[model samples]
Target chain A: MRYAMVIDTLKCVGCSDCVVACQTENDVPHGYCRDWVTESVIGTYPEVEIELRSERCNHCDNTPCVRTCPTAASHVIEGGIVLVDRDLCIGCGACIESCPYDARYRHPEWGTVDKCTFCVHRVHKGQDPACVSVCPTNCMYFGDIDDANSEVSKLIAVRKYKTLAPEAGTKPQIYYLI
Target chain B: MIPFQISGSEEVFISGRNIPHIDPHLTLWEFPISLYLFLGGLSAGILFFSAVVHLINKEDEFKGAAKWAPIVVPFALSIGLLALVYDLGNPFYSWRLYTTIRLESPMSWGAWVLLIVTPLSILWVMTYIRELFPVIKYENYKMPFLYKVEELAVKYKKYMALALLPLTIILGIYTGILLSAFNARPLWNNAILGPLFLVSGLSTAAATIILFAKSHHERQWFSKIDILLIVIEIGLIIHLIMGYYAGNEMQIEALDVLMNGEFTTMFFGLLVVLGLLVPLILEVFELAGFKVPVIIPAILILIGGLIFRILMVEAGQLSRILY
Candidate 1:
């Protein structure tokens, strides 16, 4: 099953609650983050438009990180969720260079590359990812996109949305409803 | 109501990303990777020249290229491998690179190539051990086993050369492919990187031969080859820039990084002018019977080759497609 995330940009307030939730859930180092909030201000002053996005790994179907990795450290598990095997990783940082979203980071303490896993542990236990659960604006939705009945699939099918860097042809799973 | 409008005056500002490595630039790879690529290319070039000389039966006339230069390959490769290991975050798990091979991964291809080529290089050098050092007589030292292995190596030296010819080409191209495979990095996504790196490697190897060769004839022979390779390298660089300039938005921005960005002076002044052009002109004059010291151009080419790699790695990381 292809798991995916749908984020409603209009509902997001740029409060960064998802960013804090991910760090606390993953125990990420202080200076590093697995997810981040970005505020894009476009156009000149009086005619400007602002977009607030909570961004993380796209967990692409054609993941360059998995393809470029020297060892099989980076791999896509069931549900098309890209994950890193810390034990097998030589930590060469090739995957980091190949990522288009700038999603992955080298963990300072573990010395291995780390990124958002869609909170696989929580997902397996029938719960939403920390970021989705903690988002007060209820802007985020997560489910198996492969399942026609899933919320994520329904949202993507009914709404006009966009994915980052479509020209990259990575087939990113994250959808942002404009 | 009609309002006056300015064309293409919109600006975009992004905030809250401020990530150290990912935001300002990608610094995941540093000097160690550049050194490894340089030394790896140098080793490939040395092996290529030595093997070709052996295959062509010019070992007697070009003793320096065939024997002395091959002697340096193993040492250079060893140090390069050490630099690679040092660059790894989990170097202890480096053995994992060999557990399984991913054909799509250039890094996997490099690891496998090095695994085979490193030992083969040592064996190639072993064949010339006695000729390189006359003082250590293996007969008197009671190392008949060592002597026998050396004898076998010399007997099958031609076969080793045959194997090395293609492997050297692969190794040379692999250095460039490693960087170019990162499609997300706009500056490194160009296809010309492969041949550019290969020609640079050959040129650097020729310079090294010029530096090490004892005979004037051997030095001049390689000097001419280096001049040709330098010209090809310049042509490739021009094509690379032209391709980037005509590419999409990200590629155009990537070209800006080299042409007008922070790397402009280093890329143009050091790599193009001083590294490749100056050395090319000097080598040309040297061929014309001018009393130019061969070492000057040789050293300049070596330094320039190294600077080219460092700039490619650093600037390529700084130029991203998503940004």
Candidate 2:
């Protein structure tokens, strides 16, 4: 029941619908975001190639955030969902420093570190993440990658995809197909 | 037509003019964390100096700092602990840190280590209470419990030394390992940080003793040790920088920040000159039969130790894979 996400880079248009949906669903603060878009442009003068990526917590198998957490506040739950027990969080920001992706942000009001939960609240209820559901281009895929017949598993089986910061060796759940 | 060649490379190819300015600043662990690292090392430094002086019994001057060392440990450590709690998002619930332990996490080991170190330091200090504070002397006839406790403490004093040396050493290295565990920051990812910080902590702690030393001989002895520690520290700093520079492009960029980026003035000027080298030169002069105020070099070393923590914290935060 390990959940994961696969984002199709070629299909995305940098519309940021996923960003808005994530914010509204999570009640993310005005200045902070649960997930955000990154734009990388290459080439000089008229010959230009641009890539836009939607980034968030990788929920890695070898999670540095969980390992670096002084309190067991950041823990991996049953479904490989990395969660922060806000009630227990001391908010030392060690997890923030340890993350290569810079995914987690200190919750200003909540006084704890916060990040994308993959809409775990919705997933348990048999629904898609707010970002995946609201993505206008249907570029975001969310499913149980462990299930051989799942759409995410099929996508991985069929296409060549890459995860962010592989050098980190975190084995990120999110995949990007360029 | 892009030159992008690898997957998950530590670079983003940008040939366009719209490359957003990378902020020269970013930090997650702020003032409190840096102070904790500094004070923690200082506490360990004091403990190490006191223990060594106690073992050697060569100079009564060092005995002065040994008298204060036990008392200083709880005082400085309490402040450090307070800073840690204050930095927490949930200070009230920080006891949850003790609920479980993760060996892989230096933070968890650090917490537990401090927890045990407090009581052990108190017990060690109890053994020296008669010598350190004659006003509170315990008569065997009047206070049998105090006499019994003192007897046991004196009896097991050698064991106490064994316990404290490793604990203080661990305490010193723990501060460095805490940051080194964060593999994301190339600046802190160096393996030499443990030794580097240990030397910094010891040298600074040595300076603290020399500051309070009443006799010239006592000041001279620790000053000699300080000169050696300072030299080792300089070597470690060079090694730390070279490790980053010799790394990949991302690592090289991180080293550039430490070398000549926004941290240039602080790293090279305050940390290198005023903090380390000045004190080293002065101490060398003092050691070579030259008369110089011992307090000046001692003050400089202490300031340098503090700046080392602040600059290390800031520079590591500034060097990141993403923002």
Candidate 3:
């Protein structure tokens, strides 16, 4: 299945629910968050609008992270989720360095790098990721793009969507609706 | 926008080191550690090439086959690894690099390659260990693995040379590719980096091999190799620096960091002087029919190569663009 996520910037309140949800689920190392919020602001306070974009690993299909991996530790999983094998990782941080988005983190205990995996564990258990479940704004959506009946696929079909860093050619899984 | 604490107008953090009021958005790991990898790989590559030439080609025709090939391989490989480990933040964890495989990372690939090549190389040199030290042979019997490798090298000398050629190229190219893989760092993002590294590897490897061989005949063969390698290196450096100058604003800024910033001293002083100039001088002496021995030039060349790696890695990292 071609798993995908679409984040609606207008609906996001920048409450950081996604960050907390991600941290709890992944046991992310302190001083590092798998999912975070980016804000772009313009003009004075009276006229200003803080544009918030929730960011995480795009899980690109043509990942440079995969290309730079010497031991084949970081890879794309069966369901199109890019995963890092903690067992095989040597904590060399090459993948982390290669990642343009700053999505990856070096786990304190694992010693290897970790990043958003599109909630691969939850998918295996037939459940939604904690962040999707916890997002009160319903700004985040995830489903198989192959299943046209799925809400995510239908929404993507009907709306104009964008992915981060198109020049990178990773074919990012995360779609942003403008 | 979320507030970012900047102590200066454009201060940046590069590889955990803070550069105040510098290029605030660039982050690169062009460190001593990274440079050592490049040098070490080059050293290994040169030895591989030299050994191949010695093993496959008619040694009777070559001037310094017996003395130089045997001496250069082990010494360069051994010292190269020493420089590598010494540059690491935690050298002990280096062993753990072998316990796992991460094909996505060039350093991990390099680590594995080094592991395989180091021991194989050591064994290859041990073929002449008896000649180097006759008493050591009588002290201990040979291990089965070492004996088997010796047999393999002798039996499939041509095949080994062919096999080693590609591996050496890969080992050399991977050094530049390792840094190039990081697109976030504009200085390392150039396509020419791989070729630049390949040339640097060949030149440095030549310097290292020349440094260790002591005899006159050995010096002649090594000087010949050095001349060819150094010319290629100079050409590549010109291309790389020129490309940096001709590229976009970011590339030029990065280049400025090398030419005029913190790395200026090392780049102009150590890498240019020790790595390029002195070695070139030694080569000229050889070309002019002077009677310089192999030891001094060989030592100077090796020192120059080491300094070059240090300069490249440090100079390349002086600019910071990412916070």
Q: What's the C-alpha lDDT at position A162 in model 3?
A: 80
The TM-score of predicted model 3 comes to 0.75
lDDT of every predicted structure (CA atoms): 0.89, 0.81, 0.66
lDDT (tens digit, per residue) of candidate 3 on B79-124: 7666666543335556766766766666778777777666656655
Task: Name model 2 segments beyond 4 Å from true.
Answer: B1-26, B57-61, B133-155
What ranking of all candidate models by TM-score puts the best one first? Answer: 1, 2, 3
Show what share of the native A-B interface contacts model 2 retains.
0.50
Model 2 Cα shift for residue B268 (angstroms): 1.0
Q: Model 2 chain B, poorest ten-residue lDDT window?
A: B15-24
Ranking by DockQ: 1, 2, 3
**Tens digit of lDDT per residue, candidate 1, span B160-230?**
99999999999999999999999899899879999999999999999999988879899999998999999
Error of 1 at B114 (Å): 0.4
Docking class of predicted structure 1: medium
TM-score of chain B of each: 0.93, 0.86, 0.76
Q: Once superposed on the true structure, which residue ranges of model 3 sit more than 4 Å away at CA?
A: A41-50, A124-127, A154-160, B1-36, B52-116, B138-163, B181-186, B189-191, B216-221, B244-265, B278-304, B307-323
In angstroms, how far off is B162's CA in candidate 2? 1.5
- Candidate 3 has a DockQ of 0.19
TM-score of every prediction relative to native: 0.96, 0.91, 0.75
lDDT per residue, candidate 2, B157-267, as tens digits?
767777788899999999999988888887887788888888999988888888767678778888998999999999999888777767887788778777878888989
* Chain A TM-score of each candidate structure, as shown: 0.98, 0.97, 0.93
